[model samples]
Target: MAKISVLSPFLVLFMVLMSSAPVTGQDGSRRQMVPAMFIFGDSLIDNGNNNNIPSFAKANYLPYGIDFNGGPTGRFSNGYTMVDEIAGLLGLPLIPAYNEASVNQVFHGANYASAAAGILDATGRNFVGRIPFNQQIRNFENTLNQIKGNLGAENAATVISRCMFFVGMGSNDYLNNYLMPNYATRFQYNGPQYADLLTQTYSQQLTRLYNLGARKFVIAGLGQMGCIPSILAQSASGGCSKEVNLLVKPFNENVKNMVNNLNANLPGARFIFFDSSRMFQDILQNGRSYGFSVVNRGCCGIGRNRGQITCLPYQMPCPDRNQYVFWDAFHPTAAVNVLMGRIAFSGNPDFVYPVNIKQLAEL
Candidate 1:
């Protein structure tokens, strides 16, 4: 005799709704993998923090967010930044910029990223006004207080511990500091010595977050700065600048070593270093494989390689934004941002070492 189990009417409806929900995994399990995604970085993931700042690094105008739902929301890309894609992939809502976030909004997460920001406070002084990494950390401390007031200390602490802290800085330190002809950073320290100094400061900045209850970190290494349209345009041959690329290599190496040391020394501290340089190099070396027709030129800038100057207001970008890797002289297009997001989320060990964001979130 065979026994048959029939579901109740309410049970049947529940099962149907659960099956139709968008939060289900491939194995049909329902989950919200992460509590939140607290982001801090430079223009690469700055949603709109730079808008209020009186800085030339602002990007809250047309052509910036042409591909985003709420157009021109101050993202440096054509649409969503890497964090936006990563948040969506995590089944979380888009994180709001720290300047614009309400007390209630802090539950989902907050973005402290700022255009022209760097790991060092003095890194982006040319911008006139920008939230440096130290200032951004202070902003997060304020957010933490708000969260504590909203959810009470214990619950807020739990949220903070569970949240993934993403950091993608240092590029501006090179572009706007070390590389700037007038800046004294170049004369003060050469490549390796500068890299060492940056790493030391960065290590302390990260420790600040760790002390504040951030247990999981996703640290993005500096990408190949030499291959950006701005650098490429500097050369008559329009070739990638080997010298500039060599300059950043030691920095990236030091960053990885710092991560390893942090993980070993800090109890319960877990880190996943995203090898952005390798990922960008891969795309530049094999644009065809990534559905990119233009890798060395900006889609909306002016002059040679479309990168002599940044994309101006009312500027007409390339017809096919997906075909271009860069949106402006220095930032990536939305398509490229999305690709990087996916790679950081679930790419191989080559891109995300030790573990990917997905694995870190699960942890």
Candidate 2:
């Protein structure tokens, strides 16, 4: 996924008003002013930070970027993810990966999305080589310091205030840490107990972001992990894993409530929840609607059909890539990701906010 900082439409209008007065352009070249953007999240919005990390989830391999730059760029897709699409709509450059130090100064935003990262700092401890959520924030602060030195505090404030904050994580926390290992033994709590804990932690982290000048929030909820190709294959013939799905329900519901509560608390805070479960359902309901033949079949690998591993070297790439909704077991294809981005920014009520990403950007 491409990392990005989304801008709400209202902010654009306000910026237009603020810049209505005459201002000289650099090099005598007139240009529409652009605000700086910042992004934070996991693999779904990651852009190669994990390439620097030793993780099994790394996308710096063959066939991953076959559609984009002719080679894998560490993004877990054949093309751009939601982050890239959102950034494109916002007219921002492709968000640079946090680990990619070379282009730090050129891009408007840096992606702190490490693969397998989560809401809480300790979601996936097994993936120690990867950057954690708290560390990502620390890196963000570091970047902001550099940006502040370059643009000054006042201009930096304008940049930070006007930029959209995209956070798409928390699913891994539920799937990898809490559920798979059995919360009762690992965390010594039932599913609901663990979910509440996760939600509280998520709310705190989000609050921290809000306090740090992030106002426009695009929060993506957990999808149907149980209905995913990986999970389906795991429970094949045995049927869908209702137990895990039940465990996640409260977390997703609480996430919605938490966003609402945050909106009520913060003055300019605009929280838009992307119910990924429904979006996935829509794809499964009518796969052809989004250009997919098998909603359950992945575009890569063999054992992945049995929920064994990821889209790795030994996997079989589908003949018609565009016809598949899933690129692998756990992630959506680049096409579906683009579609999701469109729904998010376009003010599509079915996907995000009360409308789409475009409308939410204006909010």
Using lDDT as the measure, the top candidate is 1
lDDT by residue for model 2 (67-122), tens: 76547888888777878776766666677787785545434778888888877666
Q: What is the TM-score of each candidate against the true structure?
A: 0.91, 0.85
Backbone clash tally (model 2): 18
Residue 280, candidate 1: alpha-carbon lDDT: 83
List candidate 2 stretches off by more than 4 Å. Answer: 1-34, 101-107, 182-187, 304-306, 314-316
Summarize candidate 1's per-residue lDDT along 176-204 as a digit string, tens digits.
89999879999999999999999999999
Residue 289 accuracy (lDDT) in model 1: 49
Which model scores highest in TM-score? Answer: 1
